[model samples]
Structures are given as C-alpha cells and as structure tokens.
Target: MKVIKLDAIDSTNDFLKALASQDELDNFTVVTAENQTKGKGQMGSKWQSESGKNLIMSALVKDFLYNNEQVFNLSIVVSLAVIETLKSFDIPNLCIKWPNDIMSYNKKIGGILIENTLKSDGRIVSVVGLGLNVNQTNFTELPHASSLAVITGNTFDKDILPALIIEKIQEKIGLWETNSTDFWKQYFNTLFKKGIPMPFKNGAGQNFMGIIQGVSSIGKIQILLEDDSVSEFDIKEVQMLY
Candidate 1:
C-alpha cells in the first residue's frame, strides 16, 4: 500500500480519484486525512467526524475486473473488512446494515462510499472510500451514530485502525479473483436484520413491514412482506426504517 497522509483535505476519495485520473495508481494505493472539510457519504449525504479522531481514508482498487453486475460485491468486501477489523478490537454486536452501513447495537459506527471507473465495455476500477468512527465519543446531533471509543469505553489509536482495515481489505481483494463463495456466505451471515421483520420505506415513500431475506448476487435486497409475497429492491428503491 502506498499511503498518503494528509493533515486536512476536502475529501480523501476526491483526492485519490484525481490522482487516478492523472495516472494509473497501484492497487491499494491509499489517501487518508486527519480532517475532511467536506466528507461525502452514499447518495450525496455528508459524513461527519471530529478532526483527527476517526478513520477517513480512500483506497484505490485497480484491475478489479468486475462488471457492473458484480459492483455490489465490492461494497460487500469493504463493509465486511470494516466489520472484521472492529471485531478484533472487541466491539460488541457488530453488524452490517444493507448497502454498506456498519452498525453496532443498532447504531452506525462506520460507512462506505464507493466510486467506480468503467472501461469501454463497462468493467470497473473502484475507489473505495471508508469512514469509521474510532476514538470520537461525541455525537450530539447524530442520534444513531456511535464510535469504537464510545462503545468500548476505551480510546484507540486512530492511525493504527486504518492500516488494519486496509490489510483485511487486501485479503478480500484476493478472493475477488476466484472462489468468492466463502466471502459471499460470510456477508449474508453478518448482514444486519437478516431474518427479522422491520419497517421499510420504498422509493414512493410508502411504508410497510417486511422480513429480511437475503440479497441477490447483484446486490438487490430480498424481502418477504407481510402478505407472504417476495420483493427485490435496488439501493435507491427502498430503505430500512429504524
């Protein structure tokens, strides 16, 4: 991993993406910031963090060679990596909220934002941006957000956590080339709210209760509604209601 440590920046993902546009970056090339002025999240949301107190990093995933259909698997890999890293720190009740939110005890502790570069035929080269709440213990406005320090009652070395997560991510990238069956199985097993009934809101803003089944290979969520009918949804099609 070629690591670039920045004191402050607008966004690590944007920085790495700009570098990738200029030239081919090595696989696992990383850019991390102590402070991000405008940190981005999925669906154009903002990721909030206290300066120098969390993990704000982006990694280059070159030559992944996955088609558009398999893009979500990349998300699965990154999310699982964060989960695995936190578990080693003994964070309790770790779970992955669908479409890449990492949660513990029903509160979000981490999230992933992935940007992709597609070839002429539409295969991908990914930029995986990760934000994990590490030592920060204050989240006054973010009612559902928590951190490793908050959950465990112990302050952690923020710098060390990112390196550990990157190492785990590298292991998952090795699986991308072959035998992804095990990774997929682990993903489903760690999925949050799996087999539980919960309220959800669809794209139309309609609300209903549904049981979490499993996600499809391409990343569509499968849910069994109250009427015993099955429905599959893309990320934008539905959202889990807390």
Candidate 2:
C-alpha cells in the first residue's frame, strides 16, 4: 500500500514499470501524478485530462498471475473496482464498456490500460494504469467524455477515490481467485450494452449490427450476429459505435 504522489510525470505506468525492473516492489504499490504529459490509452490513443483535476495513477501487481491466459482477469478485476468505487459516490448508471472502459449513463468517464511482464522464471507482474475524470468539467472537444462532477453534479476528492479503487481491486482479486465463475457473472452483468442491439465497426470500417452476448475467456467480445450466430472478436477487430 505504499503510495507515491507526483506533481507531474510523463506516465505513471511507465514510472512504475521502470521502478519494478530496478527493485523488488510490493504488490499494490501505487504511483499517482497530477499531470501526465504523455498519458496513453488503449490502441495507442492519448489520454487527455486537465492537470490536477482528475485521478491519474498506476499500481504494481506482483505474483497475482501465473499464466498469460489469466491476464484478462486483471481487466475484469480493475473494471469492477472502479465501477464499485464510483457507485459509493452515488454515480448513477455505471457500467463497463467491453475490454475495460468505465462508463456512466452511456458516456465515457474513465478508462484502464494494463501492461504485463512475464518473467523468465514464470512469474508475472502487471502495471494497471487508470484515468478517471474526477473534478474536471470541460470536455468540449471530446463529446463523449464526461467527468464524475459533471455526471453527479458533485465534486469529489480525487485522493480518496484512488485509494478506494485500489482496495476494491485487491478485494475483488481475492474473490476471483476463489470462485471465478461468480466473478465472471458479475462482470457480465455490468457489461455495457449487453443484450442490446447496437452498431459496430470492424477493423476494415464495415458497419454491422449485433448484440453483445458476453466476453470470451480470453477477453474477446462475443456478439450475437444477425444470422443467429455468435462470434468472438478481439479488441482491435471491433469498435462499438454506441
């Protein structure tokens, strides 16, 4: 539970990763920054946030994963943790956009990006980066982006939110290790747009309509197609058009 707070950094994830490589770090060691000059998102997208107005952090996870197949479990654990934390603040309509985007009322509020390193001795370490809009209110350029303050109309303490989220992540990880079946059910239940007909665009920019059934064990989104067939697609292969 060692937390390091920074005024500015290029990326909390990069800082933690470099630190882990140099020293033996405890699990759940956290690094948070007020400003990230190069914050990143899924598929190389830049994460934009107003300095000191959001929650930007990364946590080190060690000895939690044994195999590559279990990597997606981290995504599930972190997603639910954020959702649950926001719920405590009375953030309404919280749901997880597939893979791991935090949404409220069909608007993007936060996001997660996990990076894993497999050791030569068969150990795995993960750096979980999270960016949540806490007090920020201006997203004029980004139409889909919104903040907790904007959604709830109440300002939040960014410092308190990250600690709760980290605690929830640890708690959910324990539950997942004990009974994965139940964990999967919880994740599916919070899945955004589940069982609803929606439009999707593939990598080739082809639009199609499908219903999100569930996610595969390997983290691919499973969609029920128009032909009554279920197909699993990788994150890069499909994009939900809302």
By TM-score, the best candidate is 2
Full-model lDDT, candidate 2: 0.93
Give the Cα-based TM-score of candidate 1 against the true structure: 0.96
1-242, model 2: which lDDT tens digit per residue? 89999999999999999999999988999999999999999999999999999999999988778998999999988998898888888899999999899999989999999999998899999999999999999999999999999998889889987789989998987777687888788999999999999999999999999999999988999999999999999989999997
lDDT of 1 by residue, 89-199 (tens): 899999988878999999999999999988676658788999999989889999999998899999988888767988998888887668588888888889898998899
Model 2 off-target regions past 4 Å? Answer: none
Scored by CA lDDT, what does every candidate get? 0.89, 0.93
Q: Residue 222 of candidate 2: its Cα lDDT? A: 97
lDDT for residue 19 in candidate 1, whole number 0-100? 91
lDDT of candidate 1 vs native? 0.89
Model 1, poorest ten-residue lDDT window? 62-71
